[model samples]
Target: MKVALLYNQKPDLPENTPKYQSDEFAEWDNPETIDAVANALRERCDVVKIDCNPAYLQQIITTLLEEKPDICFNITEGIGEPSREAQIPALLDMMRLRYTASDPATLCLALDKARTKEILSYYQIPTPHFRVIHSLSEGMVFLNEHHQFPLIVKPLHEGSSKGIFERSVVYSVEELSRQLREVIEQYKQPALVEQFLSGREFTVALIGNGETLEVLPIIELLFDHLPKDSRKIYSYEAKWLWDDPENPVEVFKCPAPISKELADEIASLCKRAFRALRCRDWARIDVRLNEHGKPFIIEINPLPGILPNPDEHSCFPLAARTAGIDFNALINRVLDEALKRYNLAI
Candidate 1:
């Protein structure tokens, strides 16, 4: 069997670009992660790495056509367009190629937080009340009406906490307006203003499909070590800059110390969200509890981040590790689940 590992290789920044802008654009897979995935698959099948950058897309298509791998382990987060994540899958569908993870439509739907929330709400799944703001002026109406003050604003079509910062959680209209404009100008997209859930926040990872789907252990975000004034969000800085392996801050607690009842409820909600979004193979769902201990779906990551380093604070791998699944086993498990979906597993 042959497996093609597809991933985004972030290109080098222009020399004249500012540091902050360059840092923001560096959201692609690092070499270590690509190598780790390749190494994992090398033990089970013939593996080749394919770059998913738009510039080299033709080369990728040609390579796949010639090689004809049995399956593609797709983790290609496209660089441009709102439906970037779905672009590669759509191409694969055009070429009649089998790939891992959710389908193109699900990937496109999951990328838009508002649309995901709409589907969740349609299925009667719990999610926070949110408003999509295209401009800063619309934020005034959101604040004036029957809305809450403590709202968290984010780019409607971004993941990996790209547009989310420490100031995302706003307490006043001024802050909301500022953050809303920032998201609009910086991300060039609508802002998702969600009613903040103050209760505990947790991330749930699941693998497989349908009746055989397995929900791994839950991971809770710890904010005790953050600055006194910092909000309890897993902001971009906290995710990428702050949490170091050697000088860790204990940012995540796996198998979050919760009662059986709450744990079951969270797992159920995660599974429901996964199915409702039509996710396949594996996914990571973020959830937060309300003041009354009711869990609400925050967002779904079908193509979850898999940073290779053990100390890199990647939630999906951490949850798997806590469940007694190592990196290699977890990688193969995802591949095996995809193979099962296509009836290609022997």
Candidate 2:
């Protein structure tokens, strides 16, 4: 089998870049992660690397045509635009090439938090009440009508905790306004102001498709491990800064110290979401409990991050490891699922 490993390598930011802009490449994979994925794919298949850099669009397209691999293991987060994550998948679609994970439309819809919530709501799935604030006036109007304290503000179109900080969980009108402005102005995107869920948070990883879909072990985020003064959120700082291979924070509990009933409920909820969104191959859904202990969909990541290092505390791999599927097996499993979907020999 031949596979093309498509990815966006994280670039170093220039000095003096604004704090808000520092996470521009946070969703992109680093050299270590890219190499890990390539090596894993190379273990079972002939692999070729294709950097999906927008600056070299023609070159990338030419390489894809020349290589003509049977399938692409896509992990490109893309650059700029609200539909960035969908760019590579859409290109693959145009070129009539098969790839792993969700289709372009699913990727685009998943990236837009508001739209994804709308779809979930349509399917009677529970998600926090949110308003997309395009400007300060819109946000102020929402605040006047809602007047809910402890709201979570985020960039409507970001993933991997980009544009999310500890201060994102606002407790007052003033804090909400500040975050709204920061996300709208600095991130250059509408702010998603959602009602905060104060209970425990969990991330669920699902692989395969339809009747054969398998939900990996659930992962609960232990916010108590965060700094004493910080809010309880898996913010950018918490995900990228405070937690590292060395001096790792004890922030995750796999198979989540929860009742079996609760675990089944979360698994069912994630499965419903995966089918509702028409996700193929695999995905990761984040869920958080409300004050009433009801699980609500936080966000859906059709293209979940797969950092190969066990010490990094990456949720998907951690969940897979707990299920007895090692990193290499997990990679090839996704490839097999995609191949089966395309009716191609693996």
Candidate 1 local lDDT, 104-204, one digit each (tens): 89999988999999999999999999889987677667657665779999999988778899899988888888898899888889999999999999999
Q: What is the C-alpha RMSD of each candidate to the true structure, in Å?
A: 2.1, 2.1
TM-score of each: 0.95, 0.95
Badly placed stretches (over 4 Å) of model 2 are: 12-22
- Candidate 2, residues 283-334, lDDT tens digits: the string is 9999999998999999999999888988777889999999999999899899
lDDT per model vs. reference: 0.88, 0.90
TM-score attained by model 2 = 0.95
The alpha-carbon deviation from the true structure for residue 113 of candidate 1, after best TM-score superposition, in angstroms, is 0.2
Clashes of each: 0, 0
Q: Which regions of candidate 1 deviate over 4 angstroms?
A: 12-24
Please give the lDDT score for candidate 1.
Answer: 0.88
> Could you give me the TM-score of model 1 versus the true structure?
0.95
